[model samples]
Target chain A: MAEFYSLRVNGVDREVVDAQLGESLLFVLRERLGLLGTKGACEQGECGSCSVLVDGELVCACLVLAAAQSGRDIVSIEGIAPAGVSTDVQQAFVDAGAVQCGFCTPGLVMAAHSLLERIVDPTDTEIREELSGNICRCTGYGRLVEAVANVAKTRIALGGNRG
Target chain B: MTVSVPTSVAEAVSLLAAAPDSLVLAGGTDLMVEVNAGHRSLDRVIAVDRIEELRDWSISADRRSLTIGSGVPYSLVMDGPIAELVPALAQASRTVGSPQIRHVGTIGGNLGTCSPAGDTLPVLAALDAQIHLRSVSGGRTVSFSHFMTGVKRNSRQPDELITGVTLPVLPGWQGYSKVGVRNAMVIATASSCLAVDESTRSVRVALGSVGPVIIRCTDAEDWVVGQIDWERRAVDDGVVAEFGQRCGVAARPIDDHRSTAAYRRRAIEVLSARQLRRAFPNG
Candidate 1:
């Protein structure tokens, strides 16, 4: 029942071998492809810890079939930045003290990236709503919201450039 | 296990007919939950999201009906011409899970799951939308009332695939409301959709999560239609309260983990009354 397939992730074509069709995209990404940045918490879509962008749309990787994502473009946490390089959102998280346990950071970062990509200068309410799917057990949402808002403000100051 | 990715409706249906037990995967919002929980195992899954025919939608030439494809995601329903034509559907779509969930969850998935708490069910029921199904055998359309059989149950056959739903675009106002544990990322404990058709001088109300299936409050609908002045879009406060009471009486909620039966019944009354007032601002 194992299948072989290739998925375009982070602009790279990666081949997955001997994977169960029932295995989730989250499992395949972490276990098969060695992409551990996307955390698996609550296995269900509720936790949002497994958030990823498949075809530029934010979704819970735990809720997607590994084989079904064959032809789709997937962007994982590890793919978002250069090796050991943090983006503005990641830097903002550190500046705003948004990283506590760090388990939810990657998912939160992905959600924040998705929001800013669509709405460069998102309001506080928009940021909160966009990140609502992600849960930080540390209960550090206030700081997370602040981090996203600061990034949005910086982007606005730069004339809507997501640099 | 094997997975089939069909790019067309014909291929999808033929695959289903060939392998009737093939699990249909759309958004994976519900099926993945079960899979992750280890409650079910998939031997064969047919991914239908790739079918462009199931993703496309079209409006009737007369502008009286809007047919939404099964694979149309809730995010598309949140805002657009579809939202303008069926505001109630948009409202219901907004209440489904979260922004991430809305991105992939499809109306057809909601219909396939047929959970009583499915947000879009009440709106579809109130609108009297027709569910279209197709198989290698043929195609047939079923009304929303008969489509859902019970909680997480439907009339869809193993060989049939839900192609789309046709909703009538009425002139009058329509809206959807729900009460959950919290504002976002929560399932509805109780929900209601109220829609009015000025052309037909009719009022329709449907309740969700308070019954085994989407409960159409015919008593309340018939009573409200008589009480409202269609030309003025007005009704009496007492009439609205009575309609709400009737809607509450129609609920078949049970005490469960999500909510108490009494609370669900009360939520239905409050939701129906509020929706009735909002629809008839002059009340």
Candidate 2:
């Protein structure tokens, strides 16, 4: 039996139908809600393509069941830049030529955003550690790290979390 | 296909007892991986992550042990108070899947899966951790060694739920080392943990991903403890080499797809020696 779930996604109260709590939140967001920013790949939790923030903690959406997340706050990549407005991390990625295939871009952006929020200025090692979970199959990681480092500098100069 | 999200351990225990074969979902890191890969069919699941009681922890009144809830996430266990008590477990937890995986993966899930490569198992074995399990029938505790019988196999009855694990906080130095093809986000090709008890003047070494279950080198432990000065945390090169040799000998590695038997044995030796050096850095 399917149940209705009301999820606080991207600062909006969204309702999803035919919600199988057993299904991944990724399915609900992409297929049901039609918010495709949070990519789904390697559904085994190895790929961070489906990374999202549930109550401010970053988790792989594929590994997390929807039923377990009812009435919870979820911040996806789509929500990170409200109303399609670009975030600093997004701009930095474009400026630094970080995206090659662009499939892993959203997740990397979100992961980098999460780090910058906490670590206003992260070292190269910290950036590597934080973003290692989000794989860029195109092997554009060197520029990805450079882009994230570039944004961290901008965020620190602008004085913190929200720029 | 029922997904029961029990808010309490008692409810979970009853649900699991009612459905003996129901999969107990802690972090869902391993179970979901199997489900996604079409490796196993998940019929019914008892999701225990929501149970707050299963996520709590407390140190023994005698101050000799720490008991962490089965549902405690690796992120929590690897940081702050828990890490202070068992640094070896903390280091092992840090090496688990990734930040996203660690955010939700629990010590209980590592035990439940009973994978020989499980990063926590070797640490638990070295610490001689006691696993506490409960069911509607009754509650009992088992040694970490006794709990895991084989790869992805455990003595845990379907009706039973892991309540928590009680690890003795011996006055000692603890260290862990894991070898993998990549620096991050890769499972251990081979891993080893070394825990030295200062009070008892004992040394225990456990090798991971090199056998059917976490292999504790009892002879090597006795040899290392006997050879080293417990007070100074000092050991000669010969003692370290002999201890590593024993660990290499004890590892029952095979030519699995992940690694060759010879490479796995060599890794055990290298990791064992490195972890011992870390446990007694000055030595």
Candidate 3:
């Protein structure tokens, strides 16, 4: 049975009708709401290509059920920056050449965004651990690590609120 | 199809009683994988992670033990006081999946999954933790050894749910370690936990992923007592090697997708010795 679900996604209350019972949040975001920024590669939560923020907690969106997210807040990569603009983390990724195929860029950006939100000035070990779930096979981890580190340094200098 | 997200343990029990065939979802780390793969279609599901009572945990009376709710995530167990109470469990939690997985996976779910390789089981066995079970009829507790019957198998009845696990607070040294293809987010190819009880001058060692159930090495444990000097609180390098060798021999490892039987046997032997020495290192 399909039902209507109203979820506060990306700072907006979006109504989704015809919601299937076992539909994943990744599917709802991409297919239902048309928020295609959150990519879906491996639906089994192995690849973090579908990473997103559920009430400020970073998780694999593919692993979460849309129905279970009744009143929760979800922030996808599409809402990470202002309209027609890129956030520092996203910009840093392009500057550092961390976007190879670009399929994993959204997930990496979202994960880094959430990490900076919580830790502010994170160490290399902390940054690596936070982004462990998100895999970028083509880009390799070095560039992504550098991009996140670059953003972290600037965010710290900016009083750590910029991400 | 109906998915029940109960706010309390009582509500969850009632929901299950009404639908005995309902699948229990915790963390959804393991279950959702199968669901996404189209291996099994679930018509009825009960999400237990949301129930607050299922996540409740606290120190036991007399301060000699700790009671952990079934829904307590691995991250909490790693950061909270529970980690300090059982260092082996904390060590195991740190190695389970990645940060995202740890944020949701619970010890109770590990028990519910009952995978022989699930990292938490060996620690629970080493600690001799008590499995708390609940049903619409009543509640009961069982030892970890008795709770696990076989690989992905347990004595849990269809109508029963795991409420929590209670483990003793060991004042002595204890630790856990595993051998995986990679360190960050790989399942244990072979794992071992060692706990030293100074009061009895005894040690408990358990191996996982190398048998149908986590193997408790009584033979190795007995030798550990004889080998370690109570007064010196130390054991020779040879004694440690022999102890690990004995424990490894007791495991019934088989060739699996992750590793071969011969390799798992050797890995357990090396891991057991390494964890034992780390817990009771010579200064």
- TM-scores, all models, native as reference: 0.98, 0.95, 0.96
Give the Cα-based TM-score of candidate 3 against the true structure.
0.96
Candidate 3, position B273, lDDT: 86
**lDDT tens readout by residue for model 2, A26-96:** 88889889989899989988889999998887888888877667667899988886676888888888889
The candidate maximizing TM-score is 1
lDDT for B52 (candidate 2): 95
Q: Could you give me the TM-score of model 2 versus the true structure? A: 0.95
Error of 2 at B83 (Å): 1.4
| Model 3 per-residue lDDT tens digits across residues B192-280 | 99998887778999999999999999999987887777776677898879887998998899997899999999998898888777766
lDDT of 2 by residue, B166-259 (tens): 9999777788889998877888889999988888888899999999999999988877777776567787777777778899999999898899
> What is the descending TM-score order?
1, 3, 2
Q: How much lDDT does candidate 1 score?
A: 0.93
Query: How would you encode candidate 1's per-residue C-alpha lDDT over A1-163 as one tens digit per residue?
Result: 6679998988999999988879999999999999999999888789899999999999999999989888799999998999899999999999999999899999999999999899877888888888989999785699999999999899889987668
Poorest lDDT segment (10 consecutive residues) of candidate 3 chain A: A154-163
Task: Say which docking band candidate 2 falls in.
Answer: medium
Tell me the TM-score of candidate 2's A chain: 0.93
